[model samples]
Target: MSAAPPEEEEELALPRRPPPCHAVCSSRAFATLYSLVTYALVPAGVVALIEVRYAYLLLFVAQLLLAVGAVEWSWLAFRIRQRLLLAVSLHEDGPPQPQEPTEDAPDSSEHPPPPSSDVNQSEEQTEAAAARRAHALEDQPLRREDPRESYARLMAEAMRAKSFAIAPLADWLFCGQWYLAAFVLASLGAAASVALGYAVESSVFGSANPAAGWRMMVGASVEAAFVSIFCSSLAPSGADSVVLVVYQACVLVASMNAYLKLHVDVIASDSQVDPLFIILAGAIVIIVFRVVTSKVVMQSLLLVLCDVLGLVCIVSPLIAFADLIDQPMGHSFRNQFALFVLVVVATDVGDCLAKELQRHWPQVFQWCRHPLLKSEATTKDVEALAISLACGAIMIVVVRLGSGVSAFNAVEVIVLLCAMALGQWCRLWMAHVRQMAKVTTSAFYLSEGSRAGGVLDRMAVFLVAIIVYYPYIKQKYFSSS
Candidate 1:
């Protein structure tokens, strides 16, 4: 009979290998775990009830994709484990070690090593050794390609990250039932804001005001439309650029809208009715601001100012209606806004911690007597964990306190100051990291400056301009004092 084909012969060979010793094959368990935890528990059907905003549904879908990516991430870890296990098993079954050369050959220095006579023999031995090594190396690369390896790596990374978990958490939050939850909360906040805005205009300010509550709503719609259109146009450039531009625009428009609405409230109470005049004036101001500033420093300063202006938007109104700060509508709105700030702050802190841990942990553990895998209770590691926990806790507490404070009060100013100070401070200290972070963060989710030289050039000019304009502006608009 003809010899059997190699594939059939191999398949017919008796199975020599034992079953995997570990229940999960150790390598694949975490991948299975991640899939279950992230997809089944988090980012599932539950989040929808919490947020309840239609816009959040889009966010939720994005988050679901992220979670799915994470689930996929665990594959690396599984592959690594499998490779390690194979290595261990192979090592256990490998041939016995050969004996060392007896008495060795004559000492190399004394005999000058047996030269050309042994050259052919030595070459043959070297070639044989090379063949053996090459054979050993053959399966390693193939083993490395295992999908589980990626999942394992991602798990290890996720476990270590602290600062950058928001995007991850957002994925988790968006994918599951909690996505609904986030939607609901956002919806409720939006609805509450709209209702309060209307009630304030119609009941408190009177329907006869120059810009009715309805008109304010229309203005807000226009502003939002402008932001959406601009952002969409930029989207084709790249996700990061799109996110950054859109986020900045949203912040700017929201701030400007709030500022304009507050001003409209004041004007409606007493001023003239000339829609074209206000529009023309606004357009002129925009042109001047855009035209006069060409330098990077000026542009960055303007960008920050616009961001700060968003806070100013909500702040101005509360300050104007200080008596209403304690009222239910005002207090509720303030709490909600404060919560948003807290969330952003929390995200920043988490991302920073995760990044720091990622960069420094290897060096920090290098000097230990035993590696972390063996040492369960290293003081240094404990200290690091403790510090991280403490910081996270303090942030949570501070955010809670912020939420309780009335908007436009001392607490509110302090919070706003904190936001500005932290933003600038981070911008200064983590300039490079921030650039990297902006791109990385935007890659998942979607969301600069410098200035002049000398002390006098920077401060004196700045002071003179501020002093000259501050009084005039305050006297014109904020002159109750």
Candidate 2:
């Protein structure tokens, strides 16, 4: 489904959250023949000789359709695996664990104990709802409903994602069929994405050189795979799951790139490989290990050495899109490579706390979240729990501003503010999951609205960052002749 404009997306009651900020032209996404109904076409008065597609456009369009199909096929394949595991799990472990909601349970929520007054109206309502849902859900156990019901519920909630469910590939991807063939199909889909990306940038866009094409291709492919893993659903699984996906894609790509760069240099003596590749690989590994390990992000040795590389993979696509409007956003893999190397690194990890070598930390590395969160915290005594996460988010923006002295982006600033506000709205969905506390059932609901918002937030920021404003590339490469 097409995404609505920003004004409509801001309204809470929209049917679907917006799509991800994938790095492709609007012509590729909308003006192509695959979606003929869009108003992007120029019509000649009935007796028209209009050039409908570019020479390679048809081929790209074909690949795009294939890409969509592959995505559904892959998701369905995993669903089969999930179904088997769920069935086996059910057989061996018996009915799913209950949330322990009973008539005797207190549906009414408790008073917020006085700890911090930063708790706002949003948190108050969210915690109250959490208590009520927890008690009420007890009446209807998860086992009573179908296990796959959660998956189906999410598919329905995400409007565009439903098309994949009904597609023929869904049935084919199910187990009890050619399991090996299904496996092969899964492998082929990933390969196709990487290959298509390389071909598009190198041949389709006609990059200045093959090296440039391959450079841009890495970020494009990683992002494509990343987006595919989550399916076309607006909702993402959770924070940890999301981080894992991004981390894996970035790590693997960065490693391959590091090797590739050195290999090219070895083959051509004059081909000077940037020393940054080595640093990029080192930094990404160390920082990923640090970020995923705990609640507080410990600054690794590599972060100091190669902080910009961590953001490069994700931001490459963002800046490339931004380069469309502003010239020389970076050196052309359509002009993102130079700035792709540039860093707007934020000091969100709080360096003052880091110098002490603080080993004791949290289970998750969030820039914004209170110190305490537990079972009782979801319902009662949330006064302390109601930390103004927005305040914490704002603190990070301040850090980012201080970090990026030049090239302030109004769009990014707006997105950062909107994200904190959006988090408050997501509290209801989050509270429900917290209340349920069923490991099996929580998977379905944890990603509810929060996941969609995360996806949309990233897309909006990522897309605007790229499609509108280009990162300032250093003058040496793109000096006006």
Going through the candidates in the order shown, the clash numbers are 58, 9
Which tens-of-lDDT digit does each residue in 1-481 have in candidate 2? 2344333245335454222322222224432442232112211110021122111112122222223332322332233333444445456777544233234444344544434665565577767767766656553443333435544443333322222221234345644232343344445556777776666554443333346436544544544454434333222222222332343344334333333333222123355333345335545654665466535322233222222332343333422322222222221322122121121111111221221222235322333434564553343222211333333344545645655644435554454434333333333433343233221121221223321122121122223333223333223224541
Tens digit of per-residue lDDT, candidate 1, span 242-333: 22233333333333343344533533324433333433343344335434543544433433343233223222222222212112132234
Candidate with the greatest TM-score versus the true structure: 2
Give me candidate 1's TM-score against the actual structure: 0.24
User: Candidate 1 local accuracy as lDDT?
Assistant: 0.34
RMSD of 1: 23.9
Ten-residue stretch with the least lDDT total in model 1: 446-455
C-alpha TM-score for every candidate: 0.24, 0.26
